[model samples]
Target: MADTRPALPPLRDVIARHGLAASKALGQNFLLDEQLLDRIAAIPGPLRDAPAFEVGPGPGGLTRAILRAGAKLVAVERDRRCLPALAELEEAFPGQLRVISGDAMATDAHAEAGDGAHIIANLPYNVGTPLLVGWLSAQWAPLPWWSSLTLMFQMEVAERIVAKAGSDHYGRLAVLSQWRSDAKIAMKVHRSAFTPRPR
Candidate 1:
């Protein structure tokens, strides 16, 4: 099997070097656990030649994992502070990682990563719901541009994704997320897992 490891600075070191503090304004929380990131990356299977998209890849913890998993990636990060850190990953992976400097909320992920891209991200806390909703609102079934979306959302949002149609929590969000794929709680990520541990 090919090696699946990235040569880059440790997440904490990267954050420290960049003077990065999780910003409540941006809903940013740096997921520092490598094991958890690997699990998230595994959900999409071997990406092989398929392009992958990530939003708000703060400091590139999961970004590294995705590339190691053999994905050709286009990662959109709103914070310019992280560009240098992500740049290191781009260097490590050579041609594999393309870093786009922009807000994921306004960017069209499909257009950036192309059709049939697997969308995987830790997702910033503030925009996760709205971004997922926008992706779900696409005018087609099965989201022709997206292969699958493995993302992290707040507990309440995760509950709503898999909520049954008749349940009080069920609504448009449920319909939209589940219609294209079998949405499920892949894992539970606690606040303690974040670098700043979002409240």
Candidate 2:
């Protein structure tokens, strides 16, 4: 039988239609590399039927990868500017992709995710550290929700997350992460991979 599903427009076209340009102040950097996003999505272990939570899913690059990987994705994006782009992704995936337009930090991901969910993202550099701390600390509190975290930060931030005691990067972040759940630096992406590379 011939396939009759609507084809997704090119990402560039979506970006252009929505006027979605990388906003430095908003910590926006559109990931142009599909392979990197796929690798990031794969790091949290098998998606299968598990729900995946993504923060700052600007332009839905990583969001698309998660959907393609066969997981139900709930993406929280802060910028209203990108909501149209995300809406396109929601259309592409139908019921599989749910996008919330709001501040990721304030959104209760657990409430949206229910139970047995995995968190994965190419975190916005501006809020990455604080968000990681929030997630790690949440795991130790009365209501730990997510089963795992597979996120990307700046290379320096990645080092800090996986750093061990006595290592140069070791600090409160290292202690908190180690004290809670298993975590690691799953991958490193180059600056050039982003639409507006950060320096």
Point to the candidate with the largest lDDT. Answer: 1
What value of lDDT does candidate 2 attain over all alpha carbons?
A: 0.82
The global C-alpha lDDT for each of the candidates, from Candidate 1 onward, is 0.87, 0.82
Worst 10 residues of 1 by lDDT: 136-145
Q: Candidate 1 — what's its lDDT?
A: 0.87
For all predicted structures, in order, the TM-scores are 0.94, 0.91
- Write one digit per residue (lDDT tens) for candidate 2, span 31-119: 86777777878887789778989999988888888887888888999989888888877887788889898988898888998777898
TM-score of 2: 0.91
Runs off by more than 4 Å, candidate 1 = 1-6, 141-143
lDDT of 1 by residue, 93-117 (tens): 9889999999998898888999889
lDDT, residue 31, candidate 1: 88
